[model samples]
Target: MATPAADLANWIPRLLATWRAARRTQRRGGPRPPLDALLPDELREVAAAVTRLSTGLTRERELAGARYLDDERLLGAYLLFYWPISYLQARGVLSELPRLPRTVLDLGSGPGPLAFAALDAGAVAVTACDRAKQALTAARDLARLAGARLTTRDWNPTQGTPLASLTGGTPPDLITLGHVINELWKGEGAEEKRAALLESAARALAPGGSLVVIEPALRDTSRGLLRVRDLLVSRGFAVRAPCLFRGACPALLKESDWCHAERAIDPPPLVAQIGKAAGLRKEAVKMSYLVLAPPGEPWAAPPPGVVLRIVSEPLAGKGRLRYMGCGPDGRKGLALQEKHVGDANRRFETLKRGDVVALEGTEPRGDGLALGAGSRVTVLAEAGRPVPMPVDGQA
Candidate 1:
């Protein structure tokens, strides 16, 4: 199977060719502006609209009817700008899984970006569901052009249909909800609707299967996903990534903070232009995501005795590097200072949030954990690992 990056490299050029051809045909016999020339201003407008939708400042229904969705130029700008971000996000989530899924069901799959990602990740068959016919049509066209094994369905989860029923009797090995929960939050009975949708997705998961949900890293959306995390735990699903414990979320306990992850992505040329025009930062993509498997199902687990999973970016101070993380016990902080560890500081400095590390000789500090100079700090997993660490310090 091809890696997501390879698959994206092949798919993007074809989509661009199609988009350009469509543009030329739309303006046949007229002086048509260069796609690059028209992209910056159009991308700025789409970026602002996307921000509004993600922040709940504007409703999806209104945005759907607005020119952003209705106008072809704006829609094209959005697809081009968002394609790499979505692909990178999907690659990040799929990399944590123990193995490639045989089948995938992508819910609320706008333009089927994630479905394509799953296909690239070795899912033999992918089913994409969305409410918008136009989005489905675009997905179908892209899938056809790419010769990918994709099927499309027009269904709205808000209508109370069981997701499993839509997939026939064959349960999917992986289910993805990408940026869909935030839109669901806007309707009446949002809580009930979200719970029902999740429950259905869980029920539809095959044994040893996983359900992954991704949302914007905004305060509200991230907090909302935290709530979803707690709800899934309560329903007996085991979290598989970005969390070291199944206990209560530490970030949610705080009023002003939320748990989210960030990864750097190299934007495509047009996306870079749009970022410059809109003053948007294109270096890092931040999001809140959860991966859950049914209880008793086998998936990747952290190395033994590696209790704390760094959940925040490493904070570098004058002489020490501080890590805020979660453990099976609860939320804890750890500090690795240069003066104490000497040359070992270089190794510890390489550690980032989401890496699992064991503090060999540490004791509890105020709301955090402390490591002494004599302590052996070993990285158990750079991200999430399925294998155990060596007992000796040599690893």
Candidate 2:
């Protein structure tokens, strides 16, 4: 069977072709703009429009009332450019779970790209909720084209209702808030609204169920997620990834930095065209995310000596590689000298964010780990690998 990524790679082009044909037919005698002909100025205008929609502390009613959500040109641009990025983000997060969710509830599910990703990742059913009827309609159309199982519901998350109530009494195994938290942050009493939403979502988790929240990698958004992480831990939820212990985030201690992860994605052709036209480089997807389960159902503990999860990009120095990471004990910095790791030095150099590594002869330093010349380094799993659901510490 094709993986979710493979299925999407196959489905997007066909959808784009159909949309292009519809445009041609509608234009009649007039020449239609090529599907990928987003000019540099137009790209910047779109980017500015998106930022306007996103940056405020409250939803920009004027912008929302604009055809931003319903305009065919804008929607097509988003489907061709932004949808792939969101799809990759969803795929990366879902792929890390111990098992595929049988049912998913995607909140603020604009155009339902994430819902499609969940269905492709083996979800039997998906409930996508959004306030924008236009977005939900587009999502429904896309689902039909893709032949996926998805149901749409009208919801405004800012109202702070228990998400399970919207699911008709059948709680989902996975609940996702993708790129929604920041939007919630735009209103008055933002923190309270977020708290209410999270509290309600936590209450909705079934046995072994998980909640995954993803946001943009902006400094404020990343810090906000860290605060949310602390909140979840205080509420007795077990954080499954990115964090190894229930402590204050170490990355936040430095006033100049924030914690986030990066995942590379191969862009579709249309995305490449948009990138070229916009003078934007299509690189790795960067975001801050949290995965949590009910308290008693914590993720499997790491193997002996494999304590730290490298949560940031590795820093390369003269002869050593420095990793900032979180461990079972707390957040710590780990250093590996080129001579000490020997052959594994190459692998160490290539390690991406979110890798689980085992280090030998390491002792805690101020707020990190110190390695000696004889210390050994081993990678248990690279970033984005589907961690096995271990039973009693055994997989």
lDDT of 1 by residue, 1-395 (tens): 66555566676665555455545334436565453434444455646644554333223345532324334554465466666677778878888886678889999887788888888878998999977666676778888788887899877776765686668889899999887877774645665667667767877888878888988787877887888778777776677777767677878888898988777667666567656665666787778888887555533444566467778887888988888878777788888777778553345677776777776777777978777676677776676343242322443
Give the clashing pairs for model 2: 57-186, 57-187, 58-186, 333-368
TM-score of each: 0.86, 0.86
The whole-model lDDT of each prediction reads: 0.71, 0.71
How many residue pairs clash in all the candidates, one count each? 0, 4
lDDT of 2 at 106: 92
* lDDT per residue as tens, model 2, 150-219: 8999887656455666788987888898877766745456655675687678668777777888887878
Model 2, runs deviating above 4 Å: 14-26, 29-73, 160-162, 185-188, 344-346, 364-366, 388-395
The superposed Cα distance between candidate 2 and the true structure at residue 241, in angstroms, equals: 1.6
